[model samples]
Target chain A: MSDQMTEGYITEDGRKIGGTLMEMKNITLRFGGVKAITDISFDIKEGEIRAIIGPNGAGKSSMLNVISGFYVPQEGEVWYKGAKRPQMKPYQVAQQGIARTFQNIALFEGMSVLDNVMTGRLNHMKTNMFQQAIWKGKAEKEEVENREVVEKIIDFLEIQSIRKTPVGRLPYGLKKRVELARALAVEPHLLLLDEPMAGMNVEEKEDMSRFILDVNDEFGTTIALIEHDMGVVMDLSDRVVVMDYGKKIGDGTPDEVRNNQDVIDAYLGVSHD
Target chain B: MFYREAGDFKTTYADDNQTFPIKFDRYRYYAVLFFAFLIVPFVINDYWVNAVFMPFLIYSIAAIGLNILVGYCGQVSLGTGGFMAVGAYAVYKLMTAFPEVSIFIHILLAGGVTSLVGVAFGLPSLRIKGFYLAVATLAAQFFLVWLFNKVPWFYNYSASGQISAPERTVFGIAVTGPNTAAWATYLFCLIFVTICALIARNLTRGTTGRKWMAIRDMDIAAEIIGVDPLKSKLSAFAVSSFFIGVSGALFFSVYLGAVEVGEVFGINKSFLVLFMIIIGGLGSIFGSFAGAAFLVLLPVLLKNVLVGMLGWPTDLAAHLEFMIVGALIIIFLIAEPHGLAQLWRVAKEKLRLWPFPH
Candidate 1:
């Protein structure tokens, strides 16, 4: 991993301070007798790509779900921004500017690609049924505004050709891109991509990496992704958190984590002397 | 070339988002409207209009209402006939009690009444969805019918357990009652159907429709997308109920004249309307008409030709119609699950590029 020589996708306006955008303190998520994530504490900083990497059942996805408010931990406090995140409705959580793409592509299968992205803006939009019924004044204006942003997102993701195509008809890579575009459309302060490069070909993964980097660079959007690909988690991320069996085994820069004996042991699932 | 959107330019957002974006579609709609209103009157006699066309128009409204819930929102409902009864009974009672209010207002008021009741039954929707909610709606169906049957006030305490529409008219044109003309009732029904369908088109093309679609596609994802499932699902129920209720009132007041709650608003009626949606097309507005037309006209036409003209046994003819309709439903579902509306679309597409599909 490159260090200090124009490394780390940071904004031009500012420099890094060890200030946290998200702090998961003493996170413990359980299902019945099974503990999914056990007493895991992690912090994500502003304007950085952080990767949570673990084995198949290592609770990497569970951790992401907890952060996105899809799952509530049995015991933990999620500090988003400066305030404690109260137990919120999922939509409420989304409106508070945290958006996530699902592990499995969750685009509205029947809806067109453009509409799938527009679904992300459902929270930002402010219009009622009556205005929509008439469509001459505010509804029309809001629609135009929302559509412009969504179209821009479609263009940004290089999905202009599939704007009118149903998400069901698209290839896996394109669907993942559409899902990313949808999450981006929310204008989220915190963007979570769960295995964005999970099923992509090399070129598709490269395209996705570029988009992820672009999202952080251009929009100043904070990205925390769960990726299984070691190279991606190393190259794209500023810092990486390594986990094994629901516990944080290692947390630091890619080089630090890569060279850590404990991290190697966790990856190999062996005890380090 | 005639049916294509290739050269149809839309400069405004409204124009672009129109129900019929192509000029060909717009003209086709206008032509259909003209035939139903002006031309159909000249050729079809009273027996045809009263016995067949009136029922067709009335059921078409209900089908459109159901389309909003089932087709647009992807919520399955089986309580349509029951809600329609609510409209019918409510209108009947209103007509009897006041005896002075405009029939126009009563029919609409019945719709409002049905909306409230529909919302009540739509409660289980929040907790359970899909087939579960469809089953839940059956409770509303049974309960509504029970309320009308067991509670005497709905039927004006009639011993026969039925509500009848007394003399009702709009501008001296008899719309309902024993002496009411079929032409007047059909006109009244046609007007309501046109307005409701237009409003529904506007809704489905805009934000509300998207909200519903979002909920339908994936409720959990819809929530993350900032759609309030509670409000959107309920509004869908309320709005859909209002339309179903109005159609019900028309069925009772304008068409049936007198209707027994259990007999008229039973599960059979619900399935009948659902068959319309399935056969015609699920979500298409035009599918509503096609469904109503097919379901309504098929039996009548068959009865006249096969049963009456050919001197076939009445029961045999009824069985044959059942087999044909059922076979068609199966074939349509397997071949093109989209239904008659899709067929209409394909035909138009073919017409647009006749002999040059490639």
Candidate 2:
């Protein structure tokens, strides 16, 4: 069952205003009239864990996809940080310090776990091909600097033992952790985690939840995660957003959203016999 | 015990991201290149040069080109032979039209011409991939090879439907053709391969190479990462074709000294290089050279020992060569799809522990 909550983001000034770091204004997305997401207006704040929870067909993934620039909204202005963001590519979004992990484990399976994480440093690596080829000047220095940073991330994720192991051979939970570690490697301003703990076991989920909290507290990274586990969402998120059939059904703090009537109806189905 | 990365040290990123990160690997590579370029020229006689070094270097270049397409970008191209034809014919046409011009420059320029043609064929990869994409490139191979046969101009109106290498040179020293010294031809190929391999390595590690790998790994995800599939895939086609074209020119100039489309550079040549990549390693640069060398030498070694010495029938020896190569392909794919690269890796892994891998 969906949790009872309406969540909104905090303003950039650290105020409790229902303002947002990213405001998806009147977003209408369609997969040829299917209305995958319709007229959805939601804002994610500067420094909070904003969770999006809904039924399977509720288009949570679609909304996340739209935010990350994977899918262009049929009609919407996506306001991020301060000004309205024009439609941009996903790497542009990544360049803007927004990084994400997929619901399914989407890693470079053929590459080592370390190489997979190293790919996250792609945007940060500044040297060109000539520099890399000669390996004498700037490229070598940047590579070392990046490996230092990536090593810290790997250590943080406790994946040092399997650093050189190809991601294909890693267990499901470890793969999920590597995916999170990869997203974290970007040192993002906002982290979008789509079902970060979907297939993780209880112990793995608990470790992931702790890692998620540490990432939020340590880096002060604004996180917008989608979770099917209501309990984990309730325990971890500062605010929650609820959707039903692609529309934002409820938006507040955990307790206020918990008591919203529409939120109640969406989950309990209004109980019409 | 079989695979571990316990004590690999990296004092720098260059150290870590090296073509061969391990100390042992660096030594092995230098040693091999030293042999191939320096020592082998002196040790090998003229017959060995004609039958071995020439084909090996030419095929090595072609394998690296194919590796760029299939290994790095994940595009299967059966049209490598066609690109080679483009190079050979381009050289033939250029030489016929401008007889006074230096032949060496024409051979080099033919690669550029082939690159353009390759990208044109590679355009279909935008819409297709995997087996379907392979089929599309098969079209490129058959079409181009057929064109060389049908159009008499490519053969310079010769009755034999073939083209011979012009007496080409860099500085009046014979650099191509049978009369040229083996050392000159070997040196010419060595320079081009070293440069192309360097370029390929840089492209693979840097922004461009990463873009190709991103597309190769997952096109949809690569798009989300902000890579334009159009630019990335086309660049791969162009770069890959450039190398293939040059190899074609080299095959005509430095090795065969003359070629017919369906004979020297054909679908069979494509298969040979593909097998080289398979036996060497995919997506690893060193694998290209290793595969090329192994595949090229296998038949020669077979003929020398089996047919020449043992008096086995030449036809039987040829069939045996195919059987052994085919079986090796299957074994490499099944046992370690990583190919000789993995074997090299394993050997290095053992050496890292030295004296007591046990």
Strongest candidate by DockQ: 1
Model 2 interface RMSD, in angstroms?
2.4
> Which interface RMSD values do the candidates have, in the order shown?
1.5, 2.4
Measured against the true two-chain complex, the DockQ scores of the candidates, in the order shown, are 0.60, 0.42
| Model 1: per-residue Cα lDDT at residue A263 | 81
Candidate 2 residue-wise lDDT, A169-273, digit = tens: 999999999988888888998899999999778999999999998998778788999999988998888778889999988775566677889888888787679
* Residue pairs in collision within model 2: A4-A258, A5-A257, A6-A251, A6-A252, A6-A257, A7-A252
lDDT of 2 by residue, B1-358 (tens): 3233457666665666777665555777799789878887777677877788778878888899999999999999998888998988898788778877887678779988998999999899989999999999999999998888998877878878779876767777788655788677777878888888887887786656767877888676666555668877998998899889998887776677788789876788778788889789988888998999898888788788888899989899989988987787787789988889889878866766776766
User: What is the docking quality class of candidate 1?
Assistant: medium
Least lDDT summed over 10 consecutive residues: which range in candidate 1 chain B? B10-19
TM-score for candidate 1 = 0.94
Error of 2 at A227 (Å): 0.8
